[model samples]
Target: MIVRTIRVRTIWSVCVPLPLLSLMLVVFGLTTGEFVIAGILPDVAAGLAVPVPAAGRLVTAYALGMIVGGPVVTALTARLPRRPLVTGLVAVSVLANLGSAVAPGYGLLLAARFAAGLVVATFFAVAIATAVSTAPEGRQASAVAKVALGMNLGIVLGTPLGTLVGQHLGWRAAFAAVAALTAAGLLMVLRFVPASPAPTGSMRGELRVFKGRDVQLALALTAVGNVGVVTVFSYIAPLLTGVGGFGEGAVPALLLLYGAGAVAGNFLGGRLADRALMPSLAGLLAVLAAVLVLFWAAGGVRILAVPLVFVLGLLAFAIIPGMQTRVLTAAGAAPTLAVAVNASGFQTAAAFAGWLGGAVIDHGPGLRSLYLVGAALTAAGLGIALYVLRRDRRPSPEPGRRPEHAGT
Candidate 1:
């Protein structure tokens, strides 16, 4: 028994990292392809004969697709095999990115981006579900963190990767590379990822999760918290350079520091959630709220801005895995759809935040207002979480150890 246990542990240690890498690659491909368009906005506007602001609408269109597609796909595909569905979605993403590269006009590019958004939303939820399901008992947060790691890496790596490709070869070349990466992710999923049984539930049964007070509160908190963070981050470059007076070269370094902090946050958050789920959530949200406020206060000091950005990244990311864990815990066994819904909620709220931030900035509001908005939203999230924690009072379920639903 001991020898067998050791063998199993060895295999899992090796095998699990493969999934993490593959998941990261998937996020990388999606993010690189999607955000690359932002950098090429000028080129695309000129190519398609549209005004710059109108070209920006393409991004808005893609986000709209993401917000609408995620839950719709989850609800529709509730009965499809999880692993295969993920593979298929990624395959489609590759095709979409490829299409974006060769698209003839703005309308076609918009269509391609919409298609990519559809695939990305589905890809995210599936990846998270697979990670959580595969995690060992008491390690679900870590597993989900692996997916979060992919997300952070994407933000850190994607734009640069896209820029390099576009600079050397053109924006078309960048999209092609992202397509190739997506294809690679698909192959990895097919080759290494084991099949997962479909989540069992009617759409109605899944919707019941919304009826749960904790789930509703959790979803609300996620939306508000996401908006809060994005509000400030949307204007981070301006804040750092204009207000903090950091050089352009320093911006990339600062972003790297933030990425490192995020990695640390993900790992630490999982451990903290494992220790005491509710308190971890509360503490992280509170710190996140405070960090945004500090960013507002520290705007004039470069030294302060650097450390504050790091703390902001840490606090913002720490909430993700814990929030995810919270939903799974409260939802009990059948969490697949609920988890998907939460992902959608985050995306939707981010859209609202981007709009809100833009509105604030448009009014000649300084970058500090971004932090103010973030702080307010984060406080709201923390308040909701606190209320839920107080109401539940029951200890959170152990991470990675989910109860089986009736069908499972």
Candidate 2:
């Protein structure tokens, strides 16, 4: 009887985090829909009767929508109830993906992709805020990590699978698959997620987070870190093919390794942040900078490049939970809007980094220069992190008020 009781308790302990699990699934579905386009661009171009380069614009459209939409949605829906809001976001994802699957032309497809992007960051902000708000005390970072785990899994599993499906079935089928997964996520969220009231603040109050130095610093840190990551990642295929001398077949396996590393980093980062947020963040950034430097130096050696790619992915993502936690903690009363804005910062950085990387490729530096650029960006981010840490050490103005440092 005692053995059975212990077994039941163990299962319950694992099962108690199902809300996070649901959020993960939702993230996975959304991320897959957002990223799968890269894998299916050729098919989309063929089907829409547009040039492949034109099809590439679908990605840019999505990023632009995410950049513009996240904060707007958060501000406009600041007072809406949480459960229905999340469910509605998933519903929007479902409908948007369906639109993508069935759209008849390039213009319609672009609209669908943009519409999908519009909700991606907003969903992340709300879902992450919900995850943190509902999490057990002392486990907020862990909850956020679990949510990110789904995204990593999507990168590891979903994009490849979508590509395979698009290769065999059709690109539209890939979007249809995304819609189906999103529908399942919708049902899970509606069934399992508990309702929470929105934070009691006006749009003006939520907007006030921008004025906080710590909040602005956090956003800058996220942007700098992401610029470092995306600068290489956006052009990883070319770097591998051009610099590493890797064949097309090896790219997927290499990316899988990176994704696997990301999964490990996600969970580890959350645990570390839960323990010592600022130090963990600083350490992760330092490691990331070092890895980027290593990648730049050894990119031509396959054995070295493969392992460094994994380490690069690990260090790159390990900072996410810490960054999110910092913003949320610093923002105090405006967690949702702060998170939304942070997501926007990341998207904007990704767009900017891609453009910068393209310029380097087109100009004299060539593809190998991307890693160097990435290293420089990460080093800059580390400097910002160090500055933030220094600021945290200063004494607070109020006698009883503790400084709003990273973890505390």
Candidate 3:
């Protein structure tokens, strides 16, 4: 008698390193939970018998949680081995999502979302740190990008799917789906991610990295650089419908297009940053500014505007790896804390962008004016990047790690 055995492998088994893949999956789950709320906001508002604006506080609460919780969690857990720490964080997230799924009122749901956000930024920080530490020399940016690619996928696939589930079943079903995703992610992380050595330094010593001017600059650059993209993205639905005259039904398809572009731009940016970090950043920012200006001029014309959405997404994401790499390189000694702080800075910038974009809409020229303001804001960020380029003249190498090249 002959016996045959069956084996199955997932697409995730492609080429990424196992540890990084595990980290990526965990990140994907967290990101899905973070973004799915937007898709289900109206349902949540109705379900809780609250005004849509009040229900909107969940988003703000989560951002606030990230800003406050990242440092606290990272500081408390900084010395632990990466595998368990990350898995533990994912576990906490699973519970938070479950709590969100069962929340009896808006207050409880808001708290659950905050709890969920508590782990996200620090999880990202640790995941990125582990990936970089394990990467081959000179591949730091690629490693960063791979972990970040999970985020893009979450936006592209997870959010939409979760939204679908919410629409068909109920909003609570979406949170349950997110919880299930995190649970699966926790298992994959435990399976594929190798146990890391405990950190050699204490939290206090690691925190000192922020004192460096380069580190400070990297953090500021991240916040300032993202404002342009956030300003447009926050109001994308309105922009498309109001100016481009696209029907509401068309927005989803256009967003999918944008997401596809983001995936492509992310990998491309990673490769470019691996080649020449600072220069690539500068060039991408300049291009992004130009694209924003082009978008402003073309937004009224559907034919031109549709393709610009893809290009806009491409340029917006193309700079992310460079921004992340700079921060990691600048604060090599304190990856966990530095990255958490960077996450907070980016969050703060997003919050500011929302306010600024609203002001532009309410008081300034009009809805069409958003793109111009976005372009101007992007130029301001580009100026900062250029200043860093001029001041550093060469990329600051990661601590104790040899400089890969002068161009970085």
Global lDDT scores for all candidate models: 0.78, 0.86, 0.87
Q: Write the per-residue lDDT of candidate 2 for residues 327-381, one digit (tens) a residue.
A: 8898889888889889988998888888899899898488897888888888899
Cα lDDT tens digits, model 1, 79-140, are 88887788678878888888988999888988888888876767777787788777788888
Q: What is the alpha-carbon lDDT for the whole of candidate 2? A: 0.86
Q: What's each prediction's clash count?
A: 2, 0, 0
User: Candidate 1: lDDT of 167?
Assistant: 75
Best by lDDT: 3
CA lDDT, candidate 3, residue 169: 92
Error of 3 at 236 (Å): 1.0
Model 1 lDDT, residue 306, Cα? 78
Q: Against the hidden true structure, what lDDT does model 3 obtain?
A: 0.87
- Model 3: runs farther than 4 Å from truth? 1-14, 394-408
Residue pairs in collision within model 2:
none
For model 1, the run of ten residues with the poorest summed lDDT: 399-408
